[model samples]
Target chain A: MVALEFWFEFASTYSYPAAARIQAMADQAGLTVVWQPFLLGPIFQRQGWHDSPFNLYPVQGRYMWRDLERICAALNIPLRRPSVFPRNSVLAARVACAFAAEPWLPDFVRQVFHANFAEDLDITKPDIIQTCLERSGISGHRIIERALAPDNKDALRLQVERAVALGIFGAPSFLAADELFWGNDRLEQAIAWCKVPSLVGIA
Target chain B: MVALEFWFEFASTYSYPAAARIQAMADQAGLTVVWQPFLLGPIFQRQGWHDSPFNLYPVQGRYMWRDLERICAALNIPLRRPSVFPRNSVLAARVACAFAAEPWLPDFVRQVFHANFAEDLDITKPDIIQTCLERSGISGHRIIERALAPDNKDALRLQVERAVALGIFGAPSFLAADELFWGNDRLEQAIAWCKVPSLVGIA
Candidate 1:
């Protein structure tokens, strides 16, 4: 089975849904999903946005929240509007980057999203991410130490650079053999593209 | 059955697919699709985007064109990258707005899209839109006169304002009553919302 690279940012609202459901969907289609966690701050800044585009344009932001609510309702996922619009996820991303190949990375990803979006908790604090790590069935102390190490932080920075090289401009992007599909809405289509690489591509 | 309002801008690439396929999908769902032609220029300007966000941000633009190619290929719709990235569609939009209630408005919409995307013709010109009108089985001369009328022009401006008021920041947006769905990707979900409004919405 071909691998689908699931590139996501922890602070992205759309990535929350993509993180929650991508694995099961990919498994059914016989695709292996590579959970790529990266920060959107540098990426957005490169595109001349100092903040989430949603916050910059409140009208689109309003529609986005409404759309997200509908999507969450359809999927039966619990969501609460985060008190802090987009919580800092640098340390969380570093943890995921440091252990990208871990068997329990997916669980940790979901747990962090749950903390921020489902529970409306501030994910930036070390204690919250520590709780998330514990919830993902891993002891928090050692991972947090390694996650804050210089090497892991550098790895996370490079991950954002690599994402830009692959033409990913937003979170919840899927890369199937260099074909990029953006947004949670394209996850199923990305899975299908992996299933039959020839059927739905022009490149 | 509830009605689904399709809001489109002629220069929006995703709107091409939505315009081509929305009518049939709405028909199957026993829903009436009210075609709304609006300009995205004023809306984007208000949001501080001087050009199509796709163009202003080239990475996203690259993905969009490739994604559009994939979609058009999958749907067996002919596509050619227009010489202009986003050809001006003000006049075409006015033509659409002017004759929106006519039975042939849908055909005219498709023709204008084809002229710009498939045929690589300038849709902003009077001749091009007149050709589109004739292809839709309507006489072009008087309609162009009416479309270019000051009142019709103002109506198109008001349409864009109405779109902004509804929190629409992008093209190919669907409204099931007051709920908004953005992008061609959401067309199916929007239709589903129209079909069984309660099952797929929080609003």
Candidate 2:
């Protein structure tokens, strides 16, 4: 079976739809997904961007929200526009990294995405992150405590560095071996590439 | 039949593929294609960007070139990397706008794209644009002369302003009624939206 890394940012609007469908879609293609959660804030800072590109360019931002609305509707996913353009996702990302090895990590990611994009809840709040964790059948308090550990914090930071080293500027990005495919629309293309070993020269 | 406006910039890499396939695809889908040629340089300048976003962000830039390579190969289209990151497309765009009402405008647009991206020719040169025009079976010198006319120059400028008024920040964008879909990947979705009359409330 081919293994693919799904690099996602909790604050990314497009990542919501990708996180919701990737696991099930990967399973059907007989691909194994290594869910890698990282922070996009540090990455954006390196690129000299203080805010999301959607917010920095007003017209593009306007188009993105409408595009996201249409896409979510087509996917049968309910969307509730968040009051904030990009909610602080540090806590959510850290907790995600804390439970990176857990089998239910994907579930946790999806729920957190839902909390931010569908429920219009603040993802930065510990209470909200915990609620997302608990809803995913994980021990919210325990994981949140572990996630706040210095080592886990360092681990999350390292993950962000890894994303930068891999030349990823956006989420959700897919990596089949060393090849990177960005955007929610590229998800199917990434899967197709993974399934066809020749595409990645794996065969 | 439903109608869609295809807003494109000559220097846009993604627009090359869209321009090559849009007319045929629209025809097969029983939709009318309104080719809107405009310059993205002015639009980018308004957002404080003096260059392509692909160039403004290095990592994204690298990924885009690689992504375009793969996409073109998948589509079985020839791609020649231009010596310049973005060749001045002013001349090509003006010529396209000049022939906007002509029956062979789509063919002329495709040839210009073919010249710039596929053939690595400078689209800014009148000789090159003229060549593209002649190859499309249109009068090269006459069209080139008309394209450089003062009135045609103002017409192209007006089109760029019109694009901004329509909330278009990139190309190639598809507009079905009031709905805007950006990117080549959204082509089929835009077509589908146009085909389903109820989606546009025409039914």
Candidate 3:
């Protein structure tokens, strides 16, 4: 079976919606999904952006908020803008790197996205990250401390670099073999592509 | 029956997809779709943008092309990037505006969008626009001449201004009563919203 890779950033609001639903949708479509957590900050920095492109474009930002509201409402998901415009997702990405191979990685990633967008929490702060981990019955302190280890940090950076090399510049990017599908809106097409027989050999 | 307003720009790629399927989809959902053609160039100029936001952002532009490819493929539609983007859709918009009350306005708009994107035609040029119109069995020369009339130009400008007033900053915006859904992806939600009794009052 061809497994699709989903690259997401915890701080991305649209990624939140996609991460919350992709697993079930993929399962229904008879596809395997591999969740990959990466930091968009480094990628954006390389592009000479200090902030999200949406934030840089006021018109886009406004339209994005409204567009998200309607999309969330339709999906029956609760979403609120984060208090911090762009939360420090470094810690979250680090933890994600450590948990990347774990069975709970998808759940953990979903919680982080939900906390950052729906609960409007500052995901960058250790306290909030710990709280989220604890609520999920995981050792927040131990996992977080391990995530800060040199090897783990290196792993996270490598993931970001890999994304850049793969021509990825945005979050919630899906990879079906060699084809990269960027943005949450393309999630459906990404899943459908995985179902095609032609994609099996490519992966 | 509540009427859902579909505000589309001729140069919009995704609008082509939505415009092609929206009427049938709305019919299945038991809602009415009103096609409103407007020029995004005027709106962008008013907002101080010299080009489409996708073109201004390189990463976005690259992703848009890939995303459009995936989307069009999924929908079994052929799409090719136009050579001259941000095509002076002024003439097309004028023709669309003049035919706003026509029963075939939706199909006409879809053909124009397909011509611009799928056929890779310079929709801004009168000859190309005329060819598309002629193929659609409409009087290309007559429509083009009438569309450029003083009154039609003023109407198109007013339509653009109205879009801004309605808080729309993008193409393929859908309005179901007072609620607005932006982007071609939101067409389903827009149709669903039109079915709600409470929203019907706003219409």
Native-to-model Cα distance after best TM-score fit, residue B133 in candidate 1, in Å: 1.0
Better of 2 and 3 by TM-score: 2
**Model 2, B156: alpha-carbon shift in Å?**
0.6
Candidate 2 deviant stretches above 4 angstroms? A197-203, B197-203
lDDT of 2 at B5: 93
- RMSD vs true structure, all candidates: 1.8, 2.3, 3.5
Candidate 3 wrongly placed segments (more than 4 Å)? A197-203, B45-48, B197-203
Residue-level error in angstroms, candidate 2, position B147: 0.7
Model 2, A1-203: lDDT tens per residue? 78889999989999999998998999998999999999888988888999998998889999999888877877778899999879989899998888887888899999999999999999999999988888988768878888999999999999998999999889999998678999999988888877663433221
Candidate 2's TM-score reads 0.96
Q: CA shift at A120, candidate 2, in angstroms?
A: 0.7
Worst 10 residues of 2 chain A by lDDT: A194-203
Report the Cα lDDT for candidate 1: 0.89
Model 1, span B1-203: residue lDDT tens: 57899999999999998999999999888999899999999988887789998899988888899889888888888899999979999999999999899999999999999999999999989998889999999989999999889999999989988998888889999998677889998888888777667744532
lDDT of 1 by residue, A1-203 (tens): 68999998889999999999999998887888898998889989987899898898888788888888888888899999998988888989999999999999999999999898899988888899999999989999999999999988889989999988888889989998777899998887788788677644532
Tell me the deviation in Å of residue A154 in model 3: 2.7
Alpha carbon lDDT at B49, candidate 1? 84
What is the number of residue pairs that collide in model 2? 0
Ranking by TM-score: 1, 2, 3
Worst 10 contiguous positions by lDDT, candidate 1 chain B: B194-203
Window of ten residues with lowest summed lDDT in model 3 chain B: B194-203
